[model samples]
Target: MQLFIGNINGQFGELEAEETQHFSRVLRGKLGQEIYLTDGKGTLAKGVVTEIHNKSIQLELSEIQENFEQRPYFLHIAIAPTKNIDRIEYFLEKATEIGIDEITFLKSFHSERKNINLERCQKIVNAAVKQSLKAYVPKLNDLTKFTDFVAQDFSETKLIAHCEEDFERKNFKEILQPNENYLILIGPEGDFSLDEIKLAEENGFQGISLGHQRFRTETAALNAVFGLDWAN
Candidate 1:
């Protein structure tokens, strides 16, 4: 199925401006041709092209599916952005394909990169969702301070992945419960500072380990997402 993102209401919908060129010009979509549409909010529809213009492509919806392929578990990963933006973007794309619900870029004491382009990251994830045939789009949050993020109340299972051997840490796989919401924290290249780990523990976050081998900032974050995904 060739899926495009759009808002569908009742029996009609219109593609966004950016998608117009791809659908009408690039793809050479013709009037009366059938196409798929998704709102990235668990709504998928099959529609026929009704009108095609420079700014938009209008569709007459025929079939609609709600909660399309919704995952049973919710996985949210908050990690420090990598120095090389490509690595973090790679994580976002892969995680979206492997199934992730939300992401947050962290600003920590040991963080190498303190900023992120939310727009670019969102585009990567949106493309991944369509490529992977997923109806829901993962939520992307702006860079947040480590202290402030840790202090927030979350009902999901909270975990912090760090390499500090001095602190007792549980295996990430063992900490997961099927069909439950999870929020995991991955640190920077230097890993989370001891004080940061201690502070997170105080805020009801448990420390977790992703096995013996050490992974990069982006790798560890993806590992956390994959671990929860497979566990469920």
Candidate 2:
């Protein structure tokens, strides 16, 4: 079922402007019509359209499912944005649907795109969550430089998904422990530079190979998300 995200304040299930438009114009929702709302924190609320104004709508929540489809562990991926915006957008949508917890854009040595539209990407994430009927919305971090990102503290098993064969790497499947929090680093189209790889390793990130076949930055990130889910 198509779902909408509601504001989380003193009262729950407050429809935002776009959602109000979607319900009032596109869906032609009637008064007292049953609708679903999500708080994007693993809570799903079933409500009915109670008030419909020219540019607004209010829902009276009747039921709620807390911890809806919660995953065993958190998976956060820091990836270099591809040159093409569509690829990053696709990754955001598909990964959210597949249950990614957090996404961080990296500006590595070989990164083609240094920036992205945060607001637009967020909308894509929200739309994907609604489309997939998920209550949790993945967090999208601002674009960060590779050096600064690596220095940040992460308690989980940190991994750098690189393609170079010079260094010995662990197979992703074998290293992943069930229900363990993870923070993976995926390089861009040109992959991480040798210095970048060395820096990551020095910062507690183990080299991890996605597979024998090379994958794009977005593909590797998306694969990591699914791989973690599969491992759990």
Identify the leading candidate in terms of lDDT: 1
**lDDT of model 1, residue 49:** 92
Model 2: number of clashes?
Answer: 0
**Runs off by more than 4 Å, candidate 1:** none
TM-score of each: 0.95, 0.94
Residue range with the least summed lDDT across 10 consecutive positions in model 2: 6-15
Residue-level lDDT of model 1, residues 1-232, one tens digit each, is 6888887888898887888888877888899989888889898899899999889889999778899988898888998998999999999999999999889999999998988999999889988988988889899999999999999989888989999999999988776788888899999999999999999999999999987887888888878778767776
Off by over 4 Å in 2: 8-12, 54-56
**Index of the highest-TM-score prediction:** 1
Error of 2 at 178 (Å): 1.3
Clashing pairs in 2: none
lDDT against the true structure, per candidate, is: 0.89, 0.87
List, residue by residue over 133-211, the lDDT tens digit for candidate 2: 9999899999999999999998888999898899779999878898899899999999999999999999999999998
